[model samples]
Target: MEETTMLSLLPPALALLMIIATRKVLPSLGVGIIVGALILNDWAFIPSVSLIWEAFSSIFVSEGAINDWELFIILFLLILGIMASLISFSGGSRAFGDWALQRVKTRVGSQLITLIFGILVFIDDYFNSLTVGQVSRPLTDRHNVSRAKLAYIVDSAAAPICVLAPLSSWGAYIITIIDDILSDYSGIAYSGLQAFIYMLPMNFYALAAILFVFLVIVWKLDIGSMRKHEERAIVHQQLLDPTRKNVPGDHSQDLDTHHGSVSDLVIPIVALIISTISFMIFTGARAVDNATLLTIFAETDVARSLVYGGLIGLGASVLLTLSKRPSPFQMLRATWNGIKSMLPAIYILILAWIIVTIIDQLRTGEYLAGLIDGSIPTVFLPALLFIMAGLIAFSTGTSWGTFTILLPIAGEIASVLDLSMILPFLAAVLAGSILGDHCSPISDTTILSSTGAGSHHIDHVVTQLPYAILTAIGAFIGFLVLGMTGSTLGGLLVTLLIIVGIAFSLKSVITPLPEN
Candidate 1:
């Protein structure tokens, strides 16, 4: 671990393999954590057990106080779940579904609405996934869209859109890291924000992924396991796979959604969005003296703001539900069901966090970064970094972590070999991390997407892999073009052309699912 050895790769590899084989994410992560702990402790049983305990406890109790960031995130999830439940109990979801059905009128329209909503909620990926899922699920389900597909759409939008938006959590975090990287070298004319903007055009994966989502919806391009899920939805009217059990965030059969107006859902969602942005700016202002938009976003406490917004959203939901005048027993039942629905997601998140900690201790990312050597030609640097960053992120289940480890290495490599290529190299890392996060089963965004869509987690992961890979293929080609031609436009054009060709070819050959 200290020397960045290949041994660091084993645990995540084992966990991913087990997840694919068994379709049991929690147990796979638990096994990975145990194995990682054992490896870290030299295979000593007692020491490994102690390390595991410490890792688990540290999440809740850091430096003798509660870990506000981690706890607040959990709180936000619970609050959102409760709000969703109350909205359903008050008939907000059903009412909205009816309203959407009257206007939307087609599966393609419903999916497009979901995609647009996902893109608009780009302040944070977590907020985007859950909020879009909540608002779109009722509409999509009414249109006979599969939960797996909904989860895919949510997952695709979350990281890809956030990574591209300079006002988002992902952008803020990346900018801070870029600033640090810039300080290490001179003659780099661009500031962090400027560099981010320049690289936006070079972020092939993000752009390609977003475009692919639109194409998939418009072309009805359902392939792999996704086709099966879509067929089941259209033919049997089942949003989720019937064989899958213990799905997280599934309230399809648990709520009485028969008595509220469309405002019942809209008001709470609008309140949540407004309050969250307000708290983000407030908290960010307290952290910085200037209080400008960029600075505020860069310094903002995202998790804390989410918790505050969730409280307001929950309050709005409770007040609206109260107007319906449900009995005390019914209220309690709905609240319990809401809380219970989110427990599976909470459990998986904690386990994923623990395994991530173990992986960090193993120095898996550093080990991966160490693989790059000076012998490689500069023309291949962008493409290679993309693959490396993707592998690291896929293994670690964290795109930001991948960025932290690879960006510095990329900067160093570019400085030593070709300084002009710095932005392209950095852009590759960003694009790759998003690609990996989309594919990683243990990624928090991926897990939250499943929860939001009420899909079985494995189903989401399985169905999304092919789409993510296809985008990555387009991105990989784009990076190669950028490296050779030194033109962001050239790379982007080629990427789009390749994606369009592949999409149209697949559409022509594969039979579209029947309309219900």
Candidate 2:
């Protein structure tokens, strides 16, 4: 391991290939991390083992991966699942579905509306995915839209939009990380928080996601595995023609479920949202001076929201039981059942975070950071670096891991170049990570969103990639022009125009039919 730059990075790349080829995430991450650690330590057997151990240690060791944000996220998912089960038991979701059907008259309308619903839940990516998927799944199923496609739509919108939204918790985190960079550079006016609020309109990924959802609905253009499922569904219908084939009455999985009042659904969701806001305020997130003292409540938004939602559902169940007068033991059984049902989601979260931990400890990310800094050599390289960062994130299957490793490196590189471009590069890394997370099949959010939508995993992955790649290409062109011109806002404007051009081109390809 007497290192030459290019030669040293080969093992980690091979390991990533191993994971992706097998369609397995955790073991792949483990192998990649172990290989990376070994290389970083020059294959000095004991040190190499120690490096890998450090990676694994974070999962169980003090101040390790489990103790960080991953733990809160897993807990949040568990509580949300519990809340969802309770809502189902209480007939809230069903009631809301019935109300939606009454409002929507056609499949196309429902699909478009479901996309709208995805945009509506904008607080956090995790919250957005879980809420939108659960709410929209029933309607999409009714319309013969594959659950896999729905998952793609939900996942596409969730993280892409969350990072872009100024009002979200993501904005807060990004601002904290890059505050120093913004302050150091006079040209980049507006503080970190204020800049994001304005940049909301400029976020290429977020805009692309929202537009793509609408395009899919309006164009009715099917591609990738989604098209295959759609074709299968169509063929199944045609074969069952009354004149030519014996079509069994409804053999495909039925979307039927109990319908109830909107109050049942609306109450729990509203409670969750309001509770999140209150918790953030209570946690002193708005008060920097008290941030240390408020650390106790800082990460409680997810926990508080889920706990409130669960309790609210329990209260509703109580009211329903009291009106119908069920036995106490029966009620207890139902409540326990609700909690038990979330076990699968809990397991998925834990495994996903562990995989992320493995990827992070590999030290391979540092090599890429070094590579970007070395190769770029000038301010013009940030855009290309951004695209590369996205690719790394996608290949690795973890956005948090990508950001954690890349941000510091990008900052140091910017400092060396004196380009005053750290924030924008950080933005690129953030955006790149989002793009990768959006596209990567192994990404937890992608899988979770698919599961929540009741969609086939591979189907979702294939269908979504085209649109994300299109946006990425458009963003790259815009960023390229930015590197040459040396202007962030100017680059953003150009990117928006490129997106508009794509939208127009898409509109032309998908023309509407005239009435008979």
Candidate 3:
């Protein structure tokens, strides 16, 4: 209530613990929100009850948290479900899978395709997760690739790629934050864009994540729970393990319903990508007059663009179906069925949003940022900031929020302690935020990726944790080296070697399951 004191941190900590214990995301989030409300209301049960109710309803209040962007995101997810359903109902997914099977014969190739798609959709993480998951799931399923692994690939591709892509939503968002931080310190005259570029090579975690995913594919490296999931899928042809209760949704929908061609799928996917890019440019241009394309991208409203893109994609799917002479009534039914299937994921997303809001109200990120705001040794600042940013992002379940909170603090700390460490510190904060967000079970992108892959949410988290930790280790060491030598190439070399070594060492412990 009064900044992020010890008591204020209790709610999120409790929430994370509950999620780990119960493996139920929604109720765990509710428990956390209630605790936060109780603390805010001075532990009065009746008042806390009312406050909890207010928390849910407040989003709907005029000009409240559920603004146009939020609504667009919600609609986009729903549309994704419908689009996925349409593809299945029209047999496009099945056709595509069949077509893929003829060309990509092995699990490795299937995964590589999924990873490539994830990398291609780099405009936004949200888009990348949904589109890649939907597009690749069928192919992966046919190849006995675990949904957990598919979700991992999708999640890795989404945010990691966006952060590295200079023209992406993540790049724009972080750049703006860095600009604000630069404004306060006259020691440097770097624009947000320039700062982002300067730190790009230093973003070891993001680079490592993308590389590690491909390495996992090429090396067939699976460890921890992920190995078990992969073994089950490949050896037993079991996609969803019966022991897991958190399956996102029923993925056994009719994928062989109609005599649809592969174009039914490809056309909609192409339309979605094209429409999204077009709308992004249009929106960005409207936001500024005579702005360069790159500047327009920096100014674009990604959520709104996604909304239009999803709608256009949906339209294209429907039209493609109609051209094949499907009944209009059948089309409506298919769309509605798809929407219904996504309700579970949507509920989890809404709950996640509410929990994030509660954490924000409690000033969790600010509290964590404040802990490391003061002076520190120059050599230790980069690594310390990375760890701190990761912790805050993990707790709050939002990398963007982590960026907004820590970028300024990192800037101030670097300026006061060692101006030369600025790039590494900023890079550490950015990379750490992505690492934490990737690993956090409550993260929205993680949830979306799980839904897209039709994997159990906790299962996805369990499987992805080890890989995320590996990347974080590389990133931490990279930051340490950067702080000491101020050499980007040296840090990059050390980080890459560490990650590659980890991969090789783990490969011996857990042999990849043989192809069936």
lDDT of 1 by residue, 1-516 (tens): 356678889999999999999999999999999999989988899999999999899889999999998788889989988889889888999999999999998999999999999999999999998889988998998999999999999988999999999998888889989988987889987899999999999999999999999999999999999999999999989888888778788776556745789999999999999999999989999999887788888999999999999999999999999998888988898888889889899999999999999999999998999989899999999999999999999999999999989999999998899998999999999999998999998899999999998888989999999999999999999999999999999999999999998899999998888667
Compared with the true structure, model 1 gives a TM-score of 0.99
Better of 2 and 3 by TM-score: 3
User: Which residue pairs clash within candidate 2?
Assistant: 58-65, 95-260, 147-455, 148-455
Residues 467-501 of candidate 2 have per-residue lDDT tens digits of 78877877777667666776767777777677667
- Given candidate 3, what's the lDDT at residue 328? 78
Best candidate per TM-score, number? 1
Taking all chains together, each candidate's TM-score versus the true structure is: 0.99, 0.77, 0.96
Q: How close is candidate 2 to the true structure, as a TM-score?
A: 0.77
After best superposition, candidate 3 residue 16: deviation in angstroms? 1.5
lDDT of 3 at 223: 86
- Report, for every candidate in turn, its global Cα lDDT versus the true structure: 0.92, 0.60, 0.85
User: Which 10-residue window of candidate 1 scores lowest in summed lDDT?
Assistant: 250-259
Note the clash tally of each candidate: 0, 4, 0
Which residue pairs collide in model 1, if any? none
* Better model by TM-score: candidate 1 vs candidate 3: 1
Clashing pairs in 3: none
